[model samples]
Target: MSVLDTAFVDTELSKKTSIFGLHLWVVIGIVVGAVIVLIPSNLFASLPRAAGAAARALPEIQIDMGKVEHRVVFSDRGASSGESRATSGAETGSFGDENVIGEGGYGIVYYGMLADNTKVAIKNLLNNRGQAEKEFKVEVEAIGRVRHKNLVRLLGYCVEGAYRMLVYEYIDNGNLDHLAYLHEGLEPKVVHRDIKSSNILLDRNWHPKLSDFGLAKLLNSERSYVTTRVMGTFGYVAPEYACTGMLNEKSDIYSFGILIMEIITGRAPVDYSRPPGEVNLIDWLKMMVGNRKSEEVVDPKLPERPASKALKRVILVALRCVDPDAQKRPKMGHVIHMLESEDLLSRDERRIARDSSSSLREEPSASRLEQQTKQ
Candidate 1:
């Protein structure tokens, strides 16, 4: 494990008030170049304590007052010498127009290469007064020590005067991976308030990484939900969260359900260009299922049709996720199990399958009889 550079720790700065009152030691140094290392999740569990008893908190980011530079601290245990990382003086980040890759409400992402030739996405946060600072803190504290194959990694951050930026592993494409990791894998569950398809990023090999934590909330073990202002993409918001602003893991499941439907059918959550009956994706999907037209709901552009049973199973999962009652939704882990199971048909789906087969067998004869009567 790479130790903290003691050279950056100043005696006078350690006496100052902790940044954000988190009992963090405000230091004098900032991270320079990128250090790419796949750290074990448990590596930070045994970090040495700081000056005070409250300073024993590990896996949490420490920020300074003036030039706020945040870094992820790791423990030496379980880390091999081959995985050693080196930290240096602050390196320059480029933001030329040619490097711009993506833009969002709060920041513009510019593609940059580190001194070690590692590609990274530099999130230049729009100087929106306190909003940028709040987002920076949330992201750093949230995923600073988080190491998951499906979640984007936060390398480091820089806060100098009015300018603020976050360094992230640059993902080539975007797609959903495992919400189960956030909802069940972590100690204090993380609720991704925004789980729309767009927030999910994919690498060159199509591995997905969940991105954007500006609206993410950490729910403690004591509480099941967090009451906050309703914030998310329009149409993707869970009904309960939208109506009452009470958010929980179920809210994310609901959004994931919408995302699943969006993928199955090549349609937006709400499409004004669609006919009146098909304006809302969920409502239209329910109508299609009610008419026994579930097979027709799959996107026509798919190169080959999915197996009947497989398609039905996916639809079942999606419907369960978007259930009107949030309590009825399946947990992320359960959803993963259902999706991966070979025999995925529920009792109701079995009955539907039988009915669909009967309908298919009778269709040609019924049409023939009608034609004979007309002749």
Candidate 2:
């Protein structure tokens, strides 16, 4: 009787122990499931705070459109009372007295460095009112929304009190005017009404970028003709526009044509030394295209003769852009297409002779990679 009673007690103890183990596992599973469900929400809840903290720890970057100024913290050190005025119209000492990179009618450019060691070009406007202000506002609006690789970017601006400043990405290669005339020894003849080489800036890879919008006019307006005070580089100005104060987009096209010709022949638009025959780029190109000696007109520096056809096509497109009749001139968009298309469009075929003689060559150089990025 005692042995049977002891056996029953042992059996009952084993069953209770098994039941306890099962209950323990069920409690653990519930706890783990609850934790898993709460984790993602907890992480998300903390994200904004983490981001705010990080932003606070970083140096402040402020753009003041009123003064045309860009202010950047030079160090992790807190701002002094004087530096605090930077929030207003005060110009900080961070930029100091940097050497002038370039100067134009409207502004002086200075090379600046941020606290984070980023290089930037600071353009301080000399003429703050009248057409300059209009141009500045238009440029700000136009460049702010558009992010194209080919176009120079407007990082920020300041338009405070009497001061106006524009900040832009620093380009290492300087301007195309340097390459087209100075370094290459080509006299630029085409009237760049606003010419003087500073308008054409070069990118990191040495590709040319057209800059300085103070004088550039939008062409597609209903007025069709821009009746403004005659202004531009003497050599680059179109004859009609120069003679009659009536400017059009074709004026730019003419200037660009002169620039292209300068790039090709390594001659300035008005080279006094080019004997009697080759003084003007337009006249020279007119002779080349008329005589069908298009291949003869190319920059000797460029490699691969196959690109000559493309170059000639570009030249012809430039001419069409500068057609004596403003009504006949192609729009910038069409001009861009004419320059870009390898095969002639149905409409372009009427304007340009297909240059099939030159086979398709390697892709455009990496220097022009930005142009592709815009597309």
Candidate 3:
């Protein structure tokens, strides 16, 4: 209606138009920014799915024998055949010398070196083809998924048409049995069931490592509790498990307890040279322990002195481990703690007396000394 009002209206219209244009530019910038951020991610996310689908669609090739059909499982891209040694790099040899460290009734152990120079222990089945093959597969599958510091590591495997082998981390020191028995000149009183010094290996620092899973069963697992054919070394086998064929985790604990005792006393579970009354190391230890004399059970090579509390605690722990009833024995975790802790248990007086007797024996012979002095 008025000229001034008309001019003001036109200015307001121009401002509104400019504001709308700015808002539209802002919306466009946001859309462009989102596209820049999300496009690459979406493309990358779809790649794995697409590759997997392509793989699934590809025809699977199989080799047919008279009655057996074998499937080739692809491990890596560009791998021509599955027969290639699972080892990394191109280095190839029989590995017979490098891997073969020791032998036993069941298998032979070899020291294998990987491409990265990481050493591994390879156990090759010497006999029992079917059992070895099954064990190799079971171990690979079971150990691959399980991880623990105390347990040995499984690296890889080799199966060349009946030549079955398992690869594991290489321990520099031989098995625990050797240190406790052969080298120490002591007899192992423990029923390892499969007890031979070769089963236990030592690390570079001589820390004991338990190996040989071929016969190992997870004691806690229900599957392992089932009755099976009796198979184990005579000396290490628990009386109950050996006789009844009822093997459980306690069987392993019993064996471990015996091992601990052997480590402490430096005597075999069953020794032919020992007198008739002292044939069984466990029985002998029991008698000495019951009579309050532990020093008599200790290794002769060990120095004769007052029975330290440390020695008593170790003996107690060993006894607890070898309890006739598996239910009463402590778990490996507790055993490890008792071994490490100095204050957990106390020493017996008889042990001190035995130590004193040993000390007297070490002293010079009085008659011989007098004769030499006169001469």
- Best candidate per lDDT, number? 1
Model 3, residue 300: distance off in Å is: 2.4
Worst 10 residues of 1 by lDDT: 27-36
Q: What is the C-alpha lDDT of each candidate?
A: 0.55, 0.46, 0.46
Instruction: Please count the clashing residue pairs in each candidate, in the order shown.
Output: 3, 31, 20
Best by TM-score: 1
Cα distance off (Å), candidate 3, residue 127: 5.2
230-303: candidate 1 lDDT, tens digit per residue: 76778889989999989998998888778767767767899999999999998887677656677798877544
- lDDT by residue (167-284, candidate 2, tens digit) is 6667776764422211100011111235334565657654444455323343333565666667666677777887898875556556655655565555677877887767866666
- Whichever of 1 and 3 has more lDDT, that candidate is 1
**What lDDT would candidate 3 get against the real structure?**
0.46
Q: CA shift at 369, candidate 1, in angstroms?
A: 29
RMSD of each: 16.8, 25.8, 27.3
Cα displacement (Å) at residue 27, model 2: 74
- Candidate 2 residue spans exceeding 4 A from truth: 1-98, 104-107, 126-129, 132-143, 160-164, 173-210, 213-234, 239-248, 288-295, 304-312, 336-375
Q: Candidate 1 at residue 117, lDDT? A: 65
